[model samples]
Target: MNPLVEVSHLEKHFEIRSGLWRTVSSHVRAVDDVSFAIAAGETLGLVGESGSGKSTVARLLLRLITATGGSVRLEGREVTTARPAEMKALRRKMGIVFQDPAASMNPRAKIKWSLRRPLVTNGFEHARIDDQILAMLAKVNLGPELLNRYPHQLSGGQQQRISVARALLLRPRLLVLDEPTSALDISVQAQVLNILLDLQEAFGLTYLFISHDLNVVRYVSDRVAIMYLGKLMEIGPVEAVLQAPRHPYTQGLAASSPPMSPHQRGRQRVLLAEQPPSLIDLPTGCRLHPRCPFRQTICEETRPELRELAPGHWAACHLAENLPAPQPRDT
Candidate 1:
């Protein structure tokens, strides 16, 4: 089956202006030659530290920001250079849930208005807007009673549920969840996650879930992609990437994650001695080599392209073959 979303050779660079003349001094390579695909009804979790370009990837996929190069296709239609009218029409198939729910919504507008706005903007009949809003709310386990409340009146979890309701109001096929639960408490996070899973199952939704939380990604993702310094470091089935990571950066992330159970306590951990390289002045060759424990002379001289290590697993590391296999974790 064809993938629902396809991104190829995507690149985005922001020019930094300096001095009185405002000449372009340097460029921050936010996302460089990144590629991935999300199949129908699949959740592709993108995990990386802050400034790793995960959020930038989401924006590029949605065309909120134009890419400097490469292409993005949605449902077989090229969206990279789509006209305004074409993009407006494509909005129905894609929705985004930002990290901060309170900030995403209007402070003065009640939940009812917030939910109704999308449908109204999309040209839904005024008479049927209420019915549509209520149905979408039901999918997120929210009731009509909270519709009159302002964003500040609701708890973080309630606000996020409202955000989800608003996103679903358009009945989108793909949802880009950018750290959707990062602002909520741990208890509330679980509730929101469960709701997301239920909604995906009910709506046959595909997701590009972006987060720095590896444990959360592992829990919700079918496949996981690890990124660093705007490049894809590793990607594969979540179990394969998390349990037996191939790239050094991925292994470090997995090892540093808090163990889910007591039995995982004794697992070996990989720690990097150096800090992450700067995006503005990225190092030549392998970006992670400065901090990678398994760095070699070849690593410093050439950048390794992502190559398949197993049937579906891929990693971009010069010493991927020589590194010891990561211990398998219970799925």
Candidate 2:
């Protein structure tokens, strides 16, 4: 069967206008052409620093913001250019869990009311709304006793859990989680992740988990995609790609993740200098080449297309094809 969601060649550009007449506008290449698919019952983590366009991809998929180019297809149906009515009808099976749950919720509304609001909007049976709310709340480790509390009454973790319950109320098969755990404490993050895992199994859900945390990506994802300067630099299965990173950018990121095991110590992180080049006037060739320590003459003149370097593994770097051997394991 085909992937549940297919985003092919999706691009979202912004025109930045500045100075005097405002005619001198330079475009911000927010999401320069990017593409990937999400399989049913699988989680694909999208990782990058701020402004790498991960959130832009999510908003584009939901049509919260219009895309300047490319197509977003859900269940093989086009969404990039979907009409208002069609988009609304299509949204019942799709949901997003925002990073800042407190901000996402209506401060005045009680948790129970907020959780069931989606059901009410989707025209769920009135008799079923209460039961649905309770069941959804239970799934997120929330209870009926807290139902009367407003967003401000709940703790940060509880608020985030409420956000999760609200999104799940729609029974959406596809979930776009944008930094869902970043705002919570570490302990809370684990709880939320576990809850998500249990819920995914129960519902056979597909996820597009976006975050700046590599450790979180390592924990929650089956596969990972690395983005840089609005472009995808590498993508592969989580274990193979993370353990044996190919691209310099990807390796740098992997190396930076703190050692989870006590025995694996003294790992040095590869920190890059300066911010990514301006998106408006990105480097002529490889966008990452300017800061890339492995920069070569060819990297300065050519943009590497994302291609398979090995079976089921792809990276968009000239050196990806000839990466150095992995350090020996302590077998």
Candidate 3:
């Protein structure tokens, strides 16, 4: 089957300006030559450090911002060059739940009013708007009483649920969940995650789940993509990538993650040194070479393209084959 979302050689660069005239001095390579796809009903987790450009990738996929170079197709339709009208139509088919639910919502507006905006803007009939809003709330396990309150009155989890409900109100084919549960308590996070899983199963929703938390990503993703300095270092089945990571960067991430079980506690850790390279002045060769513990001379002189090393698994490291298997961790 064809993929629901396909991205190829995606690139996004922001021009840096300086001086009184504000001339373009350099460019920050926010997303550089990234590529990946998501099949229908599949969740592809994007994991990386704070400045890894994960969120930029999400925005690019949604056409929330224009790409500097590359193609993004949604269900065989080219989205990168879609016109305003076309994009407006596409918005109904795709939704995004941002990291901060409270900020995404209006503090002054009641929940019911906020939820009704999409239906109203989409031309829902006056008589059916309330019914639709109520139905969506029920699906997210929210009650009608909560709808009368402002966003400030709702708990963090409830606000997030409202955000999810708003996204699903349009019945989108795909959803970009940007750190959805990060703002919630642990118990609340589980509830929200379960709600997302149940919603996906019921609605056949495809997801681009982005998070820095490895354990959360492992639990929610079918496949995981490891990113660094605006590039994808590794990507594959969640179990394979997390348990036997190939790229040195990915291995470090796995080792740094908190072990879920006692058996994993004995595993050796791979600690990286030095700060990430600046996007404006990226390293000459492989971006991670400066901090990579196993780096060789070739690593500093040449960059390696992503290559498949195992069935359906790919990594962008010249010495991936020679590196020892990543210590196993509970998933």
TM-score, every prediction = 0.95, 0.93, 0.95
lDDT of 2 by residue, 99-197 (tens): 999999999988877887888888899998999888888888887998998889889899988888888898988989999998899899999999999
Candidate 3 lDDT over residue span 1-331, tens digit each: 4599999999999899999999999999999999999999999999987788999999998899999999998988889998989887887889999999999998899999999999999998999999989998999999999989999999999999999999999899999999999889989999999999999999999999999788999999999999998999999999899999999888877885453234543442335666687999999779998888888999999999999999889999999999976666655
Query: Can you list the residue pairs that collide in candidate 3?
Result: none
Which candidate, 1 or 3, would have the higher lDDT against the true structure?
3
Instruction: Give lDDT per model, in order.
Output: 0.88, 0.84, 0.90
Error of 3 at 142 (Å): 0.5
Candidate 1 wrongly placed segments (more than 4 Å):
259-270, 327-331
- For candidate 1, which ten residues in a row score worst on lDDT? 260-269
Candidate 2 clash pair list? none
Model 3 gets an lDDT of: 0.90
User: By TM-score, how accurate is candidate 2?
Assistant: 0.93
Once superposed on the true structure, which residue ranges of model 2 sit more than 4 Å away at CA? 259-271, 326-331
Highest lDDT against the true fold, candidate: 3
